[model samples]
Target: MATESTMTEARPEGKKLRANVKPAPYRIPQAPPMGWSPTGSKRREWVSRGMVGTIMFLQAVLTLRLRNSPSVGEVHTLTDYRSTPFIQGNESIYPTIVDALGITGARFFSLLCMLACTAMVYSWSRRLFNERVGLAAAFAFAVIAPTLVVGALATVDAFGLALLALATWLTIESRQGPAWPVFLAAPVAALAVVVNYSALYYLPVVTLLALLVSVRVVAPVMAAARTAPLVLVTIGMAAFTASVTSNQKMPESEDIGTLAEGTFHWLGLITGLALAGAGFYVKRARMGEVPRGYDEEPPGIGWRIMLGVILCLPPILAPVFLTLTPSVAPLWKPPLAYSALFTATMAGVGLVRIVGRHFRFPQWGIMAAVALLSIGMAQSSYEYTLWPNASRLAEVLATQVQPTGKYLASDPETINYYLKDKTKPTQWTPTSAGDPTKALKKMTFDLVVLERPFLSKADEALEAELRDSGTYRILNTVPFRLGWTRGTHEIWIANDVPVK
Candidate 1:
């Protein structure tokens, strides 16, 4: 009680103070959590740029190698270039190459087209998201299996996809200010279909993308105004492409599941990560939170989702659609391919968030990235370089048979290419020609070749008729098919020809 005298309580002794007082409980100094901050680091910037340069360089080298390599099945088809419109473009450019270098060597054009596609992938992703996303998107395009094959495969699809990318980039650029792109875009869509009939399938996607993009940037009336021309132009192109290829025989299609799986199943880690990135964005939106620490602002998301959906659906649905055999048969055949541009960009986003944002376990993110690249490298070697080297097969044929009677095989274009000097273009007919059994009976074909595990019920029927009719004898059977394609190839010669 006496101590209640207003003397400040005497300070406790050191031991007592220690007993009562808590040490600044094993704490880190109060500071911002340390993480990667490359924003101002020139070294980091240069290192990233270096990586991108290396990737593009490697891709260029690979495509160039394929350009000079052996011809695969459909590669020879590009040699015709007759069905290809834009006579000025195709006739002017490709003939010189075909004359100087054989069809395989002429694949340089496809390489150029693919390079344009890859460059566009980077630019579109950068504009849509950020530079990191752009780098990642380009990397995905480089390593993904389809791209590995398509990049150098001598087909018109690559060229069409390149134009699609350019048109898309222009449309995206319009978000900033210019309205002239839509006018250019409308004509571009038509031009794409004209050049590669396969491009017709993408018209709907272009229209929808334009409408969504326009809505995001301007008022509804202006958006409609911008989109109307695109819609009209796309419809006209679609009609024109159908009319042009109406007489064309369609390729046999796989089951619905097969078509869908062909694309997404092979996609592996990149696709899963892309989908997860999309889901994450949706989740964060639902929770009313913004992503933290994003280095660059992303563009409006609605159009991007529209883009991804459109790119994915055609690969899955085209099989079913082609089976219906619409009155206006599109010359473009199955697996009408599209760039998974949006998917690739999303994959880039997923990898970035995991490695940079989730510092607790960036190792896992790194591992996924490694796995994607590894799969791509493995697939690159898993050649689609069609079986039965056409040149070797031709050599075999020259020994057993006379030059230039009607030649029938699964890939007419391939046979035609190897036999160009020996045979006339009209002398070759595709195995898919209807009721070819009647022609076999007429001995209309001097030499017939059939691939076993037949491409269609019709082919199987034709083979049966050939065996039962006894009009032809087996000349040689070569084992040339491998890797997902089945073939114990059969060669038939009219029985009258004396065996050498």
Candidate 2:
């Protein structure tokens, strides 16, 4: 009986010992993290880090360049210089956000937003259908030329596009589950508006999308209550920042015009909203109605229609909007317009890839379109930069004049940059034109440079009056182009004028 009791106890102990013993090295190793393995409080870190690095590097390469070298020319230079004062004043955030981050900080942030957009697109594709569809959606975004080119510029276009893309991604992702990130998207979007006023146009669209996504996932009442405060806060913050920065009052009259003008003013917003709605509706309606007996499941007619609408909306609406509103019209002008077109093209390509199984058509078509558009734009830009009339005028002012001369020139910025330490020069402005001329009479300038191209027909009479005063003598007619036409730039010497 004693031996039996002892053996039973020892057997239990031995079993415990075997359980404690480590398995051989050949035993299956702990599975590395899979797509959706970890539960709450766990998330992938490396992927996010890698994505951030990629976004920053791509933006830097596209925008960074040596100072003093010509880059895209006047507009870019002016923007850079103008922003310098604001950046310096707000050194804490602006420096790191703008200069230190490189020339294309806005573009970098935009690209990051695009990557998030691609992620949402992939999710939408996968949830609606298969891995093949998801891959196709991603591929479509990769080759979009408009997006790539705009992404390449160091401008506000990328910033606005990025914010818009982020808003879209957050809305779409929220449909999957409780998306706290969607709420956070409001502040980021508000910041985007502060960066570029054009982004203000997207506010309504983003709010609608967020509400739509939240209603689909959570209850409508709850979602509305949750999102309402966020929307209000976003608008308030945006308005406050804009007012402080520009020292301008906000335009409160939503009577910004009738449907015709509103439609034209916010065309991109309308198109984006339509496409997003179409996409969501199609995805919801055609959840499992794939045709059988085929090797692959083709998207339903509704899906195809939605994709088509998304692809066509931008180009169709762009002209209508541009034509209707002349006040904030530059949004549709070249270079700037190119950015929107590029973003629309990218989104369209992504849609086509999702709807059509064949990718080559949209892929190659988008490439060709972008290439042709870029070439034409570049040629036009080059022509404007090398405007012969302006160049000739600058040459005369820089070379023909004697040193120690006091001169007045219209649009003196370009001349000042080129003719450092050559002459005492003052810029002619509407307010200063009279004062400057009087001063020139008093001290007697060696030469006064005035380009006919820079002045209107009325200003030509002013030029003749200055010559007729007998205080100044017309020294030479310097051919130049400061505006559009090739015209004479008068060089006047103050030899005949009495010195004050």
Top model number, TM-score: 1
In model 1, the clashing pairs are none
**TM-score of every candidate relative to the true structure:** 0.71, 0.53
Compute the lDDT for candidate 1: 0.61
Instruction: Give the per-residue lDDT digits (tens) of candidate 2, residues 291-393.
Output: 3332244446554554445434544544443342222111123222322322343343334443444454566445643543344334333333232234445
Output the worst ten-in-a-row residue range by lDDT, candidate 2.
Answer: 325-334
Query: Candidate 2, 474: how far from true, in Å?
Result: 7.0
**What is the TM-score (0 to 1) of candidate 2?**
0.53
Candidate 2 Cα lDDT to native: 0.46
Weakest lDDT window of 10 consecutive positions for candidate 1:
326-335
Return the lDDT, model 2, position 404: 51
Off by over 4 Å in 2: 1-161, 238-407, 413-452, 455-458, 466-500
